[model samples]
Target: MRKIPVKYGIEILVICLTPFLFMISESISNGKVTGILFSFGYLILVGFVIFGIRYWIENEELVIQNLLFWKTRIRISEVSKIEKTWNALSSPAPSITGRVEIYYNKKSIVISPKNFEEFKNELLRINPNIIIKE
Candidate 1:
């Protein structure tokens, strides 16, 4: 198994969870909610910090797990292209910076791994036919 370190999208996480936070806080202040809202928010936000996120390659598949709630797997052989991107529209990538987009068989996914070169080189090592653009 090859474990690739993740680059956090803290700003993106904040942006995504801010609304829930505000709602929960307001509800608490107004005594409108019990521990249920707090528990739900804790599951979503604290779960990320506690359970953590990960990316790796195993059995010729790339695996991505985020916030303890999801997992995505992609076959390395199906990957066709890789390039750095900063596209802001929405992506699985945690950060807006140093994002790499992988275009596979009729599909694409974005990931931001901390060690960019290592991640790219590892994929290339497995599938040399993959085209990479700087």
Candidate 2:
């Protein structure tokens, strides 16, 4: 079994946090009850800020887990194509760069495993038929 942590993008983080912080600050300054709700919402965001994404391999399955109660499992044998991509779309991937689109079981998902080569090698070791495009 192997576990790989996800990478993070500082720029993307800043882009996401800026407005949230601004709204919280503005609401608090206005002395509104909504400020308290905003504060709670901010805490929720902070709780998920790290994402805690882990791409772990166990037996023949690849499990993707995050801080939230979110988990995705894909069979190694089901993996069809692995292609490198840099997308801003919200996904399990916390990082914008070093993201890869994994096609599996007639479906797809994007993720960012810190060590791409190692992850790819391990995937191939389990299922040599998996196609990878650089």
Candidate 3:
């Protein structure tokens, strides 16, 4: 199993802290209980943010795991295209630093794997017909 490294882990940490900090101010102005509840929820979100995303080849499919609750599975045979993108829109990608856009069955998803070249090569090994737009 290949673990896709997270390059923007620090950025994610700051993003997750924003809410908690906001809640601290809200607590000072509102109530203690509300602050406590928000803190707990924020911690849970932090856990998810820290874990980020992981991708690996499983069986004959590509598995993208987001946090602990969500996952995306794409069959190697169904992949149609792969391209580099600057799009920062949300998908299965964990970071916006560098992203790979994948097209399959008229649908698309963006992912940011640390070792992009290796990841692309792995996919190409499975499906050579995939049009890769460098």
Best by TM-score: 2
* Ranked by TM-score, top first: 2, 3, 1
Q: List the residue pairs that clash in candidate 3.
A: none
The 10-residue segment of model 2 with minimum total lDDT is 43-52
- Overall lDDT per candidate, in order of appearance: 0.80, 0.83, 0.77
Say which prediction, candidate 2 or candidate 3, comes out ahead on lDDT.
2
Q: Which stretches of candidate 1 lie over 4 Å from their true place?
A: 35-52, 66-70
**What local lDDT does model 2 show for residue 48?**
76
Error of 1 at 20 (Å): 3.7
User: Which prediction has the highest lDDT against the true structure?
Assistant: 2
Backbone clashes per model, in order?
1, 0, 0
> How many Å off is the CA of 108 in candidate 1?
0.9
RMSD, one per candidate, in order: 3.1, 2.1, 2.4
Per-residue C-alpha lDDT of model 2 across residues 1-134, encoded as one tens digit per residue: 77876888786678777877787778888887787697778767764755656789998899988655778999999999999997667778887889999999898899988888999999999999999998
Write down the RMSD of candidate 3 (Cα, Å). 2.4
Model 3 lDDT per residue over 1-134, tens place: 55556445456567768888888778877878878787878888777755657778887688888778688989978999989898877666666667888899898888877887888888888888888898
